[model samples]
Structures are given as C-alpha cells and as structure tokens.
Target: MLANGNVLHPRAGRAYVLRGGRIVVSADEIRNADILVGVDGRIARIGEGVSDPGADIVDISGRLVVSGLVDAHQHLDKTGVLRFTPNPSGTLQGAREAFAKYARNAPPDDITRRAERTMARCLSRGTTAIRSHVNVDKDAGFNGIEALSALRDSWADRLTLQLVAFMTPHPGQDLEWLEANIDAAVEKADVVGGTPAVAEDPFRYMDILFGAAARHGKPVDLHLDEHLNPQRPLFDAVFDRVRKFGLEGRTVLSHVSVLSAMPRDAFERVRNEILELDLGVVTLPAANLYLQGRDADMLPPRGLTRVAELVRAGVPIATASDNIQDPFVPTGAGDMLEIGRWTLLAGHLRGDELKTVYSMMTDIPARLMGLGADYGLREGAFADLLVTDCADVDTLVAGGADAMTVIAKGKPVFDTASRPVAGDEHRQPAGSG
Candidate 1:
C-alpha cells in the first residue's frame, strides 16, 4: 500500500484523494476524514487529518460520501418499449404482447444508446452498479446478449454493468440448445436469468433453469412471482433446487410480489430457507405495486416482496427498478432511487429503518451482486463511491437525492454541476426547495 498522508497510489489503476468529506467507512463508521484512492481502484487509505501535499484533493465539505448505489434487477432493453398504455387486464396477454413487440422491433443500436442514457441517468442519481437482464430467446438470440455485452465492456471503467441473459420458453427448443445458450451468455456475461413462474410448468422449468446455471458455474436469477395470488410453494421449490445444486450465493429470486399475501407460516418457512440457502432477494417494489392490486377485493395487498421480515431475519435483500415502460410496469425510467423511494414507503421502513432501505440500493445490493469489495467506501475497497447532497440516509429518499459526484475507480465519472447546457433553465437548485 503506497500511502502518503491520506494519499494512496493504488497498484495499477488510478488514484485521486478526497478531502474533508464525511467518510462512511463501512455501513457503521461515519467520520470526518480524507480518503486515498489507490492505483488498483481501491481505497488506499482513510484517516483523519490527512496531509497529502502533492496529491490531487477534492474538497467535499458539508457533504455526505457513501458507496454508490447498485441496482440488482433491471431490464435495460425495455426502455424502448414505452409506446403504449399499461394493460388493464394485467393478464399474460399484456406480458406476451409487450414481449412480442420488444422481440420484433427493439433495434440493437437503439438498445445500446438508450441503455447508455439509462446508465448515465442512474449514475447521476447515484447508482454506480447495475445488473441488467437482457432478453435472449430464439427471437433475439446472441444479438441481445451481444448488445448488452458490448455495453458492459464499454462502460467497464466508469460503471459496473452485469448482464443477465433471460431464458424464455420457445416452441420445440432443444434442452441442450438451452444449455448451450446459457453457457454462451455466462461466458460473455455475469448471470443466467429466467422467468420460470411464467413457464407452462413452473417447477419443472426451474429444474432446467437452475440446473443449467449450476452447470455453467453462474448464478441464477428467476423472475419468481410477478403476479398476485401467486403459487406460494414456488419459492420453496426454488430454495430446494438451490440447495440441491449447492448454489447458495449463486441464486437470486426477484419480484416475489405474492409474499405479502402468503400466510405467516408460509412466509416464515420461505424466509428460513432463504436465509439457510444464503440466496439474494431483489424486490422491485415500484413495478410490483404498479402491476398488482388490479383485481383486488376487500384488501389490496402491498404487492411488495417480504422486506422487513427478511431483513429482520438476517436474510440478504436488495431493491430494483425492473422496467422502464414495458407492459408489466410502465412508470420506470431506469431510476433506482424511485424504486428506493417506493420501497421506503411501501415497506414501512422509516427513520433508522431508512438506513436498511438505503442500503437496499447500495451496500446490500452490491453484496447481493457479489461486488461487495468494489462497493463500499472502506480501505482496500474500490474507489467507486457516491457523494450525495442528502445530509443523512433519511433525506436520501425524502429529497430525490442527486449525486453531486460519482467517482468510479477514483476517476470522476459524473458531476451534476460541471456541465452547464444552454436552454436548460428548468433544473432546480441543489437540495429540495
């Protein structure tokens, strides 16, 4: 560790020291200190009264410095599918129609451009890492994976983008072909993804999905329960498969919206199994609230994954922005903060509870994505960090927090006030007015 005062010369990447910021050293230690970003893109040093004379120092007085946010479940390709209104029926018809339109019409170049814009937007909103799920059925095939893979490579330095290849059922598709496709994706990407609950036989299809993922040595991300009145046994089946394959940290179950309606015992059982398996949970509260409760009777369910109980029980959980304008949820514009805000409101996490909700977008989610070392603002961690206008965690949700600066690997990747565009007078002043 090359250290000078708080000045760190990380091994081989880049180095920039930040001074006088309220440094969050891990999730618990918040102190006034300076940070040294090393050459290998990790934090080289963090201490009080740093005195680096020659190093470049960024003054961050009166601001809060924290780890950049991580969006664990996102559909970057769906941003282009914002043409139509949401389906009122909330049936498979809507999901199929939207998927068809995307399959046929989503141009690769358009996806890359929009995905870039979405990434920039996410960074501007403090998200430094994202796991984007790309559709890769027979329709798009390698084209979808290629586009997303290219985006991942292009944005590697500025932001971390992990691609998940989505597997959907097709007519007469060979099982070996499915395995091959998933293998190709895992070779090129991060995780193997599927929506097994939408399959003709959800349980059997899960066996295929998880088995393939296990074979490829990649994680499994299943779109578990996106609808209300969901088959509660499905989660248990998923956990069983995870245990069977010894894919504990290598599995993620997203959008389990039906858990709010499950009986207490069922919830307890799933929660216990989830903790035992050490599987990650990604709750898309924004999309879930939008899609569910369409046909509710006396009491409409919250439509969120079980967040409080899971967190209280030591189960790792993350929140996500699932869609931009697809048929499932039409409101997202790739904003993880919106998901965080909705999670705070819908999950009833407030005050000190807000800390956990905030971590759902940052530390917890990063750990869920297996990027923990590159996530936090600790020594030897990646220099990737978020500087926020919000003084504390509570205001991060209350004020639509803007990332004053996003440093990726010690290089400044985003700054809200650096570039002043002409005819852009509509921007509000810093902090909520």
Candidate 2:
C-alpha cells in the first residue's frame, strides 16, 4: 500500500487482485467474483474464491465493478469553447457559423491545451477509449489532425484516442479543393468522416468521400441526415454507396436524427436496411436535442435517433457526447454516465431497458470502435475496469455514484477515495468516504 491508502504494486509486471466486488460480466449478468490481473496487464482469472498469494490484494468488498466506458463519437477540436463562442440561436447553422469564425482565429497551441484538459477530464471519469472527430476542412486545415495526433501519442498509456478526419464543406465550394484537403487529412487520420446531409450534392459528396476511403483502404464514418426534414433522401444515398463499395461493418453513420420524423413504415424500412448493411449508428443526444426541433411551433419533437427500436432489431447502435461545451452543445463534462442519463431520459429507457442503455456507453461502443476481443472483463481481457461504490446498476444509474477506483492496463491511475477534499464532513457522500 502507498501513502494514499490505495494498493498498487511498484515493480514492473507485478500482479494484483481486486477482491469481493460485484463484477458486471455482461448486460444481463453480474457475478460476485474476485478479479486477478496478471503481470501482463490482462485478467488472469475471475471467479469465486479466486486467489493468488503472490499478488497484492485490494479488498473492495461490496463494490460494483464494470468495464471502462468507450466514447465512440466526439469532437475534440471544438471542446471547451462555448464561453468564447456562444450560439444564441442554438441551431445547426448558428453553431456552424460560430465555430467557423472561431476556428479562423484560434491558434494551434490554444486548441492543444483545451483538448488536453478535456482528455484529462475524460480519463478521470473512467473513459479508457475514445474516437474523436477532428476538423479537416479547408477553413480549419490540417491543424486539428496534427495537434490530436501528437496528443494521441503523448496520452497513449492513459487513454486510447482514435482520430477521424472530419470534412465539413460549405455549399458551392470547389470540390477539387475539398478533395485535396481530405487527402491530406486521410494521410494523418485513422478514419475518414464527412457530413453528407450538409453537402450541396449529397451523391457526389458521398462518392468523393467513399472513393477516397476505398483508395486508401480506410474505414468511413459519416454524419448523415442530421436535420429534421423527413423528405431528405441522403440516407438512402449513403446506404447505396456502402453497398456498392462493399464496406459493410466498416462504415458508421452518426446522428440520423431525421429518422425520428419518418413515418412508421419508412422508419422500419430504413432500420432494416441499416441492419442489412451491418453499419453502426451513433446518437448524439446532447447536440441533436439542443440544435434540432427549435423551429417547431407546437409539440416539438425530440431530436434523437430510434435507439430502442434499433437495439431491438439487432442493429449496432451506441450513444456519445458529440460536442463538449462548444457552440453546438454549451454544456457537458465529457462524462459517459451523464450521457447515459440523457439517453435514458430522451430515449425513454426504463426498467430492464436501462441495461441496454448502459451498454451503449460501454460494450456497444467498444465493439463499434473495433476494440479487440479482449476488451471486456473476461479471463483473457485487458485489465481496464472501473470500480464504483454502488453495488447495483440501479444505484449507479440513479446518479451520484462515485468512481472509487479506475484501472488502466492493470495500473491504478485514478483513486477518487484517496483524493484530498476541502469541505465539511457532511458534504462528502457516503460512497466517496
């Protein structure tokens, strides 16, 4: 044990055991087991009465342990700029205008500093992996990708950051210029991203993006049909391209909020098509809810994708914090739990539905990001887990559940219980104590 009351081995490749915690093995299963992480930073064993006398043991009896959270869709370049750039109209166009102006004036050093702070905040909240979309259009240039690539290497041990090159093109812009910028981004980014719904010609826009991705053999993640217009046919165009390029399971569509306004028959048809294509979907509840449905005169619709329905149809779907404190969404802490809460409320998840909602932030997104088979808390899985003071899912979902310990690759990186607080005794919650 160290001076902080947290037990962590000092030597390299040292073993440790987390004892007597309720481990969440899956969305529908929880077991009272002790986890033994081996010297290789993988789970050596997980079961009742599991023990390794040579390993250091941390007694976490009566605690709840779950896998680390995965945020599949996020905008790291625009994080923490809401105060400086406010969107009074709170519409998608308003956000675009505000951010475009800010990007022109913001320096690379300033962007890096803000992104680093956001990453630290995400780490403290038990997010072990993230897929962040960086701006790659002509206005922002390659500055966002360059900064994020450096940060990804610098913070490799604490967090896994996958950078996606996001191409945001304005109407009537020269396609040749946009294609050249995208080519530069693909040379440096892990994935290629585009917003087909905002393009002047959705088909040509998708053709350019898909052509670039195919030529480079990179995966595609597009922001499709983000508006409230139900008559827009951009989503069909995307499905056609995915089929034509045979990019099934390698493509992801984020923020299909327009589906919420579709008629029942049309919605089912599109949902089935998505399942057939084996494409993944990411819902941005915070940004969509704030930016969409603002023009409705009465009984405004909730700007969200069909989460429950898609999950029921065996479609791969996940939820994420799209914009953190930016012009699109002026409030967020980069917390998956908070995002889960919003999903629960907006998606109408309750009772056993809560389990699927929780998985949206953990297992579902991890699978979408193609995290390897050894991602969860199995025998051969990586030792990335979060131990909270809540003993059950309900308590954790009810809010105020403190993350007691966070382990990244078998190392105790965050210990909330050991942190010194400056406050009265009563102010601290029982779980943190």
Candidate 3:
C-alpha cells in the first residue's frame, strides 16, 4: 500500500487502508505496519506489507497510528457548566454546592447540549472511548442518564461511550435520595458508581454501590477519597466490598488522592489489597488538582495518588480528566493527552515511564472499562484508531503532535485541526533520556 513510503492521508470515509505508520499496539510494542480496514468495522489485517487493491489507501508514513485514547473517569452530566454555575471558591465543597444548585434547575435538553459538545471535543481530539459518570439522585432523577443514554445510542458508530450511574449526594440531595433512585440509574447505565467519601458512613455508601452492581451484574466504579487529608481515607470499605460482592475484577476506583498522603503501612496495605483484588485504579488529576488541598498555607500537596509506585507494582492503573469546563475543574477540553501529562506531573512520575503514561490514556483505561480484549491495534480488533502527527510515544505524550485523523470502526469520522495544549513539548529521540 505504501509504495516507496509515499505518504497520503486517508480521504475515504467508510473503508480504507492506513498504510505505512508506526502502529503502537501497546505501551511496549511498536511496529511499522499497514492496516486494512474492512467494511464490517474491524481491522482486516495489520502487517509490514499489508495491501489491498480494491480498497482505498491512505499512506500515513512518518506518523504514529495507535489505539484511540480513552477517558475513563469523567462527569459528563456536569460538564460544560462552568459559565452557568461558577465555583468561585474552587474547592470541593464549593463545586458540589454550585453544581447541586445548577442541577435542580437545569433541563434535560440543556444537559444533552452540554454533554454533546463535550463528546464532540473528546472525539475530535482522538478520545474514541469514554466512561462518563452521570449524577443520579431523587433531585435530578434520571435526567442525566436520559441525556447521555440517547447520545450513547446515537454516537455508537463513532465513539465507545460507557455510562456510569454515579450515585450522588449533595446538600439538598442526601444519601436516601441516591439509594432510592440508584436502581433506575443503574438500569440505564453501563456501570454502578458513587463517591463514598461524601457519605456519612463510607462503608454504607460502598455497600450500596457494590450490592447494586452484584444484583445487576454490572461493573462498579467509585470516586474514592478525593481529598488531601490522610485521616479521611476510605479505601478499606472498597477493598472489603470487592471480595464481599465478588466484584474483584468488576470494580474500579477513581481519584484515590488520599493514597498520596497515607502512612507507609496504610499505603502498602491498600496497594496489597489492590493487587490481591485485581482491581482497576483510575487517578484523575485534572479535577483533583483544581478542587483539593485548599486549606494548605505553604507548599500545597498535589492531589494525585502514588502513581509511580502503583505502576511499578503492576497495578492496573489508568488516569483521566474527571471534569471538563465544569464547576469542579472550570477548564478542560476533553483532551486525554493533557490528562496524561498532568498525571505525570501531579503524580511525580519519571521520564522513563513514558510508555506507561501513554497506556494510562489508552489501553490501561480501556482495560479498566472492560474493553481491553478488543481495544488495541490488532488484526481482528476494531479499527478504532488515530493517525497522529508524532514520531513516537514520547513526542505524542510530550505534546509534540498536531491534529489527529481519527478512524473509528473502519470509518473516518473527521480530521480535526485542533487539540489541547499539554504544556510544553519535550521530544528527544525515542530511546533517549
């Protein structure tokens, strides 16, 4: 397909040949290969010399073609509400208060409009998959679910959207309301999730979520310990319930910022439990950094978990943007690269862990969402990929890439020219220090 390495961007929409690119099958595997996408929305073949005379061919030489990025921890229901409901204090409680007030009056159509814009931003920037948490309570009822569910069905062809019924509790909306309406929410969502740190009894909060997941046979994802105080740790409940509900492989923990401040023994205990349970860990730094550690007078603590240690321990950890232009974060464009870079900074990860960092945005998160089996660049995998303008993983994650030519399920959706500015670019040969 790539004659003499002749380069050309894919122009055909449905089925085509992505010829000659550095195909990143995983964090550690990179191959210069050609990909043939069949009309059935799966990759027909991928090899060094793949070709097809009958199909359209687009040579992507000198570029990096990898699996589409995944944002596994996002609040889609509360996205794009920064202007409508501003969190002037920029604290966790402030965001909760502001959004809770806004949710009471926000209409379903309005939620749909905001979420649709957010999804478009994510898709154009090469995030072809997302697991968004929708707030579910008596106050909002199923409005958030209603909006995201419709969009999920419509965007099924272009993006893989997994909805989590986030059992939420605010000032006016308490735990009772959330418990009462979780069933309806879980029925509409792909996962069962909640923030146990907010509940009066953290154990009770976790039990409710795990019980619901067990009853419905759904995966569980909970926002845990999103604060800076070491004494406020709530991971014990999560570790116990994973075994109690037999949700070891089906459970995911998000925003475990307390791990950063925990004592060594406590940290090791949690880490051991995580490894024992075969759990999925998602560290969301975007909103954590924005909303946590407000009371610090001197050098503030970075609101992130022990990412480097957890990664070194072989834990299935992923990172994502928890909020986008919402009361919680106030600034974000649904860029997974930006989120990855932030994870490295806030989590104090080393430069040699670039591949692992890249995985946090792609394969690791895909695995956390239970899409790992068919998520990456393989012969029979879905052709959900992005032909990015980067020489390698370091250049791409270091912000040296431009717009992405996204292809989802063998179909070229749109070639967008805009992406998030992930600080400064850092490119030094692939294997260099």
- TM-score of every prediction relative to native: 0.87, 0.92, 0.92
Residue-wise C-alpha lDDT for candidate 3, range 340-374, written one tens digit per residue: 88888888898887788998988788888998656
lDDT of 2 at 327: 94
Clashes per candidate (backbone, < 3 Å):
5, 0, 0
Q: Residues 1-433, candidate 2, lDDT per residue (tens digit)? A: 4534545433456787787788988877888898998988889999987878677767777678889889999999999998888789999989988888788878888889999999888888888889999887767777788999999898876788998888888755667777777787888888889898877776787888898888888899888889889888487888888888878889999999888888989999999888888889999899888999999999888899887788788888999999999999998998888898888889766666777877888888888888877689888878888888764665565563544677887777777753433553422233321
Q: Cα miss at 105, model 1 (Å)?
A: 3.6
Say what the RMSD of model 2 is: 3.7
Q: Which segments of model 3 are wrong by more than 4 Å?
A: 1-14, 172-174, 416-433
The residue pairs that clash in candidate 1, if any, are 10-38, 10-39, 10-40, 11-40, 13-39
- The residue ranges of model 2 lying beyond 4 angstroms of the native Cα positions read 2-13, 418-433
Instruction: Estimate every model's Cα lDDT from 0 to 1.
Output: 0.72, 0.82, 0.82
Which lDDT tens digits does candidate 1 get at residues 239-313?
778888889887888877777778888888878888877888888887777767867777777788777878788
Q: Model 1 clash tally?
A: 5
* Each prediction's RMSD to truth: 5.6, 3.7, 4.1
Candidate 1 segments exceeding 4 Å error: 1-14, 51-53, 84-93, 170-180, 230-232, 400-403, 417-433
lDDT of 2 at 82: 89
